[model samples]
Target chain A: MKKIINKPEDYLKEMLEGIYIAHSDQVTCVNNDLQCYVTKTKKEGKVGIATGGGSGHLPLFLGYVGDGMLDGCSVGDVFQSPSADQMLAITKEIDSGAGVLYIYGNYNGDIFNFDMASEMADFEEGIRVETVLGADDVASAGPSEPGEKSTRRGVAGIFFVYKCAGAAADQMLDLDNVKRIAQKAADNVRTMGVALTPCIVPRVGKAGFSIGEDEMEIGMGIHGESGIRRGKIEPADQIVDEMLTQIIEDLPYNKNDEVAVLVNGLGATPLDEQYIVVRRINQKLETAGITAVKYYVGEYATALEMAGFSISLLKLDDELKELIKHPVNTPFFKQ
Target chain B: MKKIINKPEDYLKEMLEGIYIAHSDQVTCVNNDLQCYVTKTKKEGKVGIATGGGSGHLPLFLGYVGDGMLDGCSVGDVFQSPSADQMLAITKEIDSGAGVLYIYGNYNGDIFNFDMASEMADFEEGIRVETVLGADDVASAGPSEPGEKSTRRGVAGIFFVYKCAGAAADQMLDLDNVKRIAQKAADNVRTMGVALTPCIVPRVGKAGFSIGEDEMEIGMGIHGESGIRRGKIEPADQIVDEMLTQIIEDLPYNKNDEVAVLVNGLGATPLDEQYIVVRRINQKLETAGITAVKYYVGEYATALEMAGFSISLLKLDDELKELIKHPVNTPFFKQ
Candidate 1:
């Protein structure tokens, strides 16, 4: 593998160690456990926002823990779910007596562990815990009906859910209110992705999957799961159009709808390429009469060094628009 | 080649189109020239800081143009210097009678063009333009004497110079003071990098260079220029240690010297690997009794999709410490 890591077993631990060393002023581990990281900003009576998932996707679960965002995160190995104990530990650390909300992706292992953690937190510490699973990857599962509860694999669109929910929590919203906002964000956002290359988990020491020299995969999962279509590489505009079409149709964003567009690079995709994709998205949206009010183009979520990009759109209302604009300062994300 | 682009010849234009579309609120093209981009925040009395370089490195030259940072940038094609006319246009757009400063990398083509632009601006518009070229890659040239003017190639360490200079300019420092701070930053910072793989320029449609699958080139330039050493890839710690050792000795940093550390990804290098490298740098600095007061770890300067990372250290004094902390809100950079 071309990865700049040491022993395969040391990947996650060393990364956590580095994160703590670099951001100690803003974040800390719960009871010195690296797997349970929490923000140092403790505002009493504010509803706690907690998230967790597999590693590899930086700035997603862990990188979002800081001012105006998540309060804590349970970290796991690359593409592997964190243990329930780790999640529970994070819950105990972030809870400030206003209850804690669990926000994470809709992966089977993560769903299982986060649910268990919620149960354990309630049983062991009498902490009220709620959950909101991000299921915004429209390619994973199409919405059968409008406003349906999707089983879609969560991807880059989870960031919007975190932003809305975190802002509500920071404003000292009640648990039910915060959960409502989180659910709203979960319902409104949709994402679709294309991959040009595969990334290897350090332990695996080889690419998880392979693509031909001139090929790309549409709707590929972050962990190299089977995509909906695998074919020869298309132009950036064409690729973006295909992805955005799926996302727009999935949400069926109406004419005159306002959106916050996120053009996310998987890992190795350059910012230049992401912007090119953004240009196409903007054109498509304009043609569809959907207005893009905000643009976030960069690597927000990634799969190791995989080369590709994802397009996520969050259809916004007045409440969601105001909440999304709320300021945030985190180790990886800031506004 | 595996790239998500349309026409290779249209790469730079398309990328710029996307950038303008995404960040039009903060930046604008001067006189309808896409190659000349300037910030929209006009402060009449503040010193205008302008920078430019090749197009591939995002969040570097053009990305720095915004509030509290660069006021303008002259954009070039991939790995090529922008035209002198472009520089003059940017200088004219940003200058508000307080004068403008040209801050860019110490590349021959850039130096030649920016110098010409400065002369043209002074000759035509009576706008004073001072220049500070970032020459901080210690691996490119060794310091024969202490505090010597390096002829080294500019690399990721240029971001520190931009931060320091931009902050100084934003604080309404006179042209001389801003230029002095920029020079101070340019002199004190040092960087070294390693590349695991080569990147292909779009128009070229082939890898710029090649290395063995298991080998890495230490101190490789951002543009794939030859480095000081080539060998089998080592652990992240070892690579970081080697790079840090050279940076420390080049400046001959002493015990208790405070510094701001920047672990920058070139392109394909993942945040996980960069953090692993950061962990080593932290440990090494601690062992050497150097205090690290700030950390900026991410892709600040990149070479398209090259697989590598660079380590930069700005030996910070109180003045630089305060200036670096000054607020900045650019499209790609925010603090």
Candidate 2:
């Protein structure tokens, strides 16, 4: 593969090392540690927020750790789960007398590891751990009442879950209050993405799936899951229309409900394309009478060199609105 | 081209529309205009800051417009310059009776267009425009006396010049004061980059130059200027060591001088790789007895889908340090 890397196996280690050196002000490796990293300047006395998952998704787990963001993150290898030890260690490092909140996307390995870590923390130390799983991918499961809470693959909508929960934590809300807001953010959020090109994993030189130059897959997962539909490439407006149509109808978003829209580029897609998608999303929301009062269009979450984008809508109430609008400063996210 | 775009030629227009829609809270189009976009949330009574150049490099021109950044940006087509008319119009719009400070990368087309705009503004509108040309790319020209203020391509170091100047303007500094600080930032900064792969321009749909799968070019320009050397792709630390060796000696960055380090990804390179490079950079700086106080590693400046990274260092004095540390919030940059 034509990558700017020395070795495929060393990719994860090198990446974490880079994050440590590059963002020393916002984060630090736990005791020169790469597996677990915590925010250097976290808000004190708040319910410490933590999130983590497999590597390769830049800024997802580790990037959101600073002022008004996560307190710590436990990172795994590419597409592999971090050990329970790693998670427990980071959890202990970030716990500030007020318990810890582990908010992550609902993936099998992640669920197992985080659960194990929480149990380990409870047994080894008397630290309380509250969990809020991200299950916002609309294509992962059929929507039942209150929306399918389980088995739904969490995707880019984790951005909202982390942000709202982190904001609440920044405000020194208790563990219960932070968990409540985080769950609300998850329930109110829905996301779907389309991929124009396949991403090449560093270890594997070939793509997971072959895609034609003139086609795209709608509802593509960050892990490059076979999407719901594949068809010829469409204009920005058409793509946004189809994706938003599904997301809006799935939630049955009310005519005048408020939302914060995230147009996230999956790695190699340019910011220009993201904005075009956002422009169309704005028009669609207007037509649907949904007030998109806040918009974040950029590379919030990314798959390695994947050429596509995911549009995530977090239907907002007044509390979520205040949390979303709260000032945040981190290496990857600043608002 | 395997891009999620409607037409290659329409990229710039669509991007501006996206930015206008996404950042409505911070910026507005020049009355439904794509060529000129101005900040809606600029600090009044401050010297209005403006920067513009060719499109393709996101967040450089338009993304840096808001409360603590540029007041306006005159956009161009992909890899092409914006017209003098656009610059003059934005210059007029961002003028807050404190005159306008024009800060941009030192590219030929940008220099010509901005010079023409300033001339037109003087003759036609009687607006005083002071410009701080960004010439921080060390490889662009030989380092002569007084730091070769002219004949250097701006590259990523322009981020600091705009940032410090914008911060000074936010402090309500007069036009001359802002210009002075911006110039200081430009002179104190230097950058060098290497490209592992070439960028595919949308208009062309083909790369300008191609490197061997295992080969890399050191000191390559953002526009793909040929570098000082090319060889097998080495490990991240080795590459950073060589790059910093050149940069440190160029300015002869003293033992105790404070500076800011920016590791900029040229579009398609992964953040993980960028961090690995930063790790080596920190090691080298410490060995050289230089103090790196602030670190920014991400895609601050990017070429279209190019897999490479640039390292920029800004030698900071007390005034420049204060300006850089000043709080500023924009759609793309917050510090």
The candidate scoring highest on TM-score is: 1
- Model 2, residue A284: distance off in Å is 1.4
Instruction: Please identify model 2 stretches exceeding 4 Å from their true place.
Output: A41-45, A142-149, A204-206, B42-44, B142-149
Q: For residues B1-335, could you state the per-residue lDDT of candidate 1 as single tens digits?
A: 88888899989988999999998888889888888888889998899999999988887779888888889998899999999999998888888888998889989999999999999999999999999989999788954687665569999998999999999988999999999999999889999999999999898999999899999999899999999999999988888889899999988778999999999999999999888988999999999999999999999999999999999999999999999899999999999
- Model 2's i-RMS, to one decimal, reads 1.7
Query: Whole-model lDDT for model 1 versus the true structure?
Result: 0.91
Retained true contacts (fraction), each candidate:
0.79, 0.62
Estimate, for each residue in A195-312, the C-alpha lDDT of model 2 and write its tens digit: 9888788788678889997899999899898789999988777888889999998787777999999989888887777887887888888888988888887778888878899999
Q: Estimate, for each residue in B1-335, the C-alpha lDDT of model 2 and write its tens digit.
A: 66767677777777777777777777787756777888887556778888888888886778788877788998888778898999999988888789999998888898899999999988999899999888888787765587444767889999999889988888888999999999899989999998888877888988898789889999998889888999998877788888888888778677888899999988877787787787788888888888888888888888877888999999999998888788877888887
Displacement of residue A60 (Cα, Å) in model 2 is: 0.7
